[model samples]
Target: MFRRLKTSQIVVDVIVAVGFFVIAWPIETITVTGALGFEYRLGSLGSVLAGLVIAGLFSGALALRRLSPALALVIAWVGALAQMSLGRPPGFADVAIFGVLYATAAYGSRTVYWAGFASALVGALVITVYLTAGPMYAGGLSWQTLPLALVMLVAAAFALGLSWTIGALVRTAVRARENRDAQQRAEAETAAEQERVRIARDMHDVVAHSLAVVIAQADGARYAAAADPAVAAGALATISTTARSALADVRLLLGQLRHRQGDGPQPTIADLEELYAQVRTAGVQLRVDVDPAAQGEPPAAVQLAVYRILQEALTNALRHGAPGGAVDVRLAWLPDHVDVEVRNPVEPGAPAPARVGHGVIGMRERAQLAGGGLDATEEAAVFTVRARLPIGDPA
Candidate 1:
């Protein structure tokens, strides 16, 4: 509840209320000297009591700052009338203080104008009572005081309007700041979610491809050992190498979960030839056409993206294509872009496979991250995967 009141406004209200009471007490004594027909000292005591009552009224109004403006205005007006009726020379201070309180409640709402109207009416009434009654009871009422009361009413109206304008501006500034902060927080969360999806895709590509190669080589070694010792030994050696390499790759990927900064080695486009050799050793006939003149060195992220795409495409071919069928790998390096294509003959009876698995999704995501694209298609008896990476464009 306290959070609603601005600290400066609270302090100002308290100070103003106390100041008015201090000033009004002494002035009341002088105004009532001849009219009350009492000793000046006794009149001064009465004035002090009146000042205390008015102070209580103003303090009560300030305490209700967060309440409805209409309710607070009604309370303040009642207190102002009471003070005017009891005091020796009724003053406009009560109305002026209430006007300021009403203005404060007007911020960011239409309550200010209504409160101002009510305060002005009450202020005019208090002034009229002071002018007619004080001197009339003493048999010497004057006309000069009417103009003074009118002047005070005009000044009160101006103060109320000015304060309301300032309060409205302050409320607008606060709301704008809150909206800007909310937008920044939302953007940060969106960027974090995208990074998480990218990491999941990379993990799927690495694990799926490595395990497929190891399984194919192990099966070849088991079948060939009885027929030819030399071929069986070669197959076993290739299986061992494939398993070790896969283990290392898994370790590298898992390290990313531990630390984001320099936790393991990063593979790039230069590793593509070694990748082809492994698939060839697993008994698939692999053909490679890579241009040496192509931009040999690309940005680190682009290099990693290209390596992952090729890895996923080759793995899919080895797992799904005909045994010992030709898997063609093509790389065309242009002045402004590089294109990679992998195509393999589809095995019989598996046309329109059940689903394109995570491998294809990973390849597509990597291509997108590098400001490129991937397309996979099946035409006639062949399945093809193609990716294009732009050199200078970073999306």
Candidate 2:
């Protein structure tokens, strides 16, 4: 409840209050005259005491203007009426009403703002009536009275209305700035979340596919060691290479949390040859066919999607297909899109892979995110995965 007070605002209020207190009596006695041409002249100590008391009330109210504008406005108007009752002319303390009006518009609630505005209208009417009907113009209203009343009304309204308008403009500007800041914060949060999901999917693809290759190579080396030492050594080499690539990719993904940097190198369509060789070493006879004329280079994002989709499909074949079954990979690059198809014969007795495995889901998500489509199907003892990814302007 005890928040820090604004030092600058307090300093300004104090200066205004002290200035009003010091000048209220002197300025009236020296320069200002009554509406009836009567000049201020101090007759006794009581008049001085009354003047000081009224100034104190006005100054005190001014000090709390920003803290509670409605309360300050009430106190200031009361002080103004007191000065008028004593036939005293308007003093410098009257300026405090404008500041109070500004505070109401800037910080006060809806009721307070409307109350302050009503006070302005009522105060103007009261001042005009007091000048024309009070002892200052006791001879009765004359031709000059209407103009004088109009001047008073306009002056009062202008002073109070102008301050309120300025405060309202400031309030509008502040709210706009706050809204802009909130929108930017929300956008930043959304982008960060998307990045996190992308990284998670990449990790799933890398780890799952690598582990499948490592298992296949290990199993093959165990069986081939007695038959041929060279074949076992080559299998061990493939396992080591696959494991190192997976480790490097994982490290790069983890580093993203600590620093913002390029993702180094990502596998693309050009690396499919290496992928095919790795699958061949894993004991799967792989056939890859590419239409040379259709090899127009695709965008990097599409290339990455294509590479990951193909990788995931082949990994599944290695894990679930018959040990000696043949796998076929076909690539067709078109003007606006690229199509990839991988097919393998399902093992006779082994159950077909799940229609929505985690790996398949990851592939589908990747393809769709790249503005593409993917399909996986099992029919006639064969499992097939196909994807079509948009490129260039289509992306």
Candidate 3:
């Protein structure tokens, strides 16, 4: 309840009202003289009651300042007029005018703010005329009185103008802060969307590669089951292992939805041997040649990119290339980059893969993100995937 009250605008305004009342109530004497040739003073119990009542009216008006600045300013002006009617000149109760003017400039609409500015000019003129024509000055429309009246007019204008200007400056600052926060939120959303795309690409690579291997092994097992049961058992074991690994990877990818980065290690260039063994077990003739210098461990990010590129290339070759065709993989280490090339024979009369295929798009995106480039081409029944990735610091 206390927390709620603290957060409530009405409660905060009430507290401000109470504070203004406390400060303005004790001042029973007004500084300026009235038309009666004497300074206005409230010196009796009845007069004290009148002053407190005026203070309450002013404070109550101030409490509504933020909610309705135009209304609050009008109400405070009414209280000022009542005080003047009671033979009181300018006094502490008039301080509420500053707050009301500030609210008008800070929160009021354009129509309301312009109206408040006009009111300020008019109010300054009225105060100047009233103070100069008072009985205490003992003169009317004289050169001596004119100078004092002009000074009073300028002083009043300056005071109100300062309050309004301060509120206007505060309004500008609040707008700037809100704009900055909105931009930050937009950037955060963009980052989250990019992360989701990355996860999706990773999931596709894992599932597609595992499924291709399982299909190949299942087909081979079906043909060999009667002739050699042992061979079929080995094929079954390969399918089971590949399925379990794929399931684990899928779980890790889904965990990201809950903002959890799983503790599982990411596959890297070192995992290429296992990947190669899997493809060979699926009956594809595979040959790998890695440059000795490039075999040195690279940064984790570059290694992960290399592994995904290789995995996706092998999966495509096994799925779409001629059955029992030879796949050639070559890795060359240069001074600044590592180059990977995979070539497989396309079956005769087989249509070339679509240029906008999701698998090819994912590989291209991954290569570019890793500071590299990738290209796929089909020429004379030969399919090729080539990628060049920048090498990071030795790991």
- On lDDT, the leading prediction is 3
lDDT of each model, Cα atoms only?
0.68, 0.80, 0.82
lDDT of 1 by residue, 1-395 (tens): 12356777677766765666566545544434543322223455666676666656655555454433455556667677776566434443454454445444443145554555555555555555554444334433448555755676666556654555565566567668889999999998886577567667766776777778888888887898788878889978887887788788777766766665453567877788889888988888999988744665777777788888889898898788877789999988787778999999887678432255677777887888889999988887788999998887675
lDDT for each residue of candidate 2 in 1-395, tens digit (9 for 90 to 100): 11135899778878877877787654434334454654545566756676676778777777777777778888888888887877766666677777777877776777887787788778778766766666655554578777877887898778777888887777688789999999999999998888888888889888988999999999989999999999999999999999998999999999986685666688887888888888888888999888643555678888899889988899899888876889999988877788889999987767776453688888999899899889988888899999988877453
Pairwise lDDT winner, candidates 1 and 2: 2
Candidate 2's displacement at residue 118, Å, is 3.7
Q: What would you estimate as the lDDT of candidate 1?
A: 0.68
Name model 3 segments beyond 4 Å from true: 1-7, 18-57, 80-88, 110-122, 133-138, 262-264, 348-351, 355-357, 392-395
TM-score of each: 0.71, 0.83, 0.83
In candidate 1, list every pair of residues with a backbone clash: none
TM-score: the better of candidates 1 and 2: 2
TM-score of 2: 0.83
lDDT of prediction 2 = 0.80
Error in Å for residue 198 of model 3: 1.3
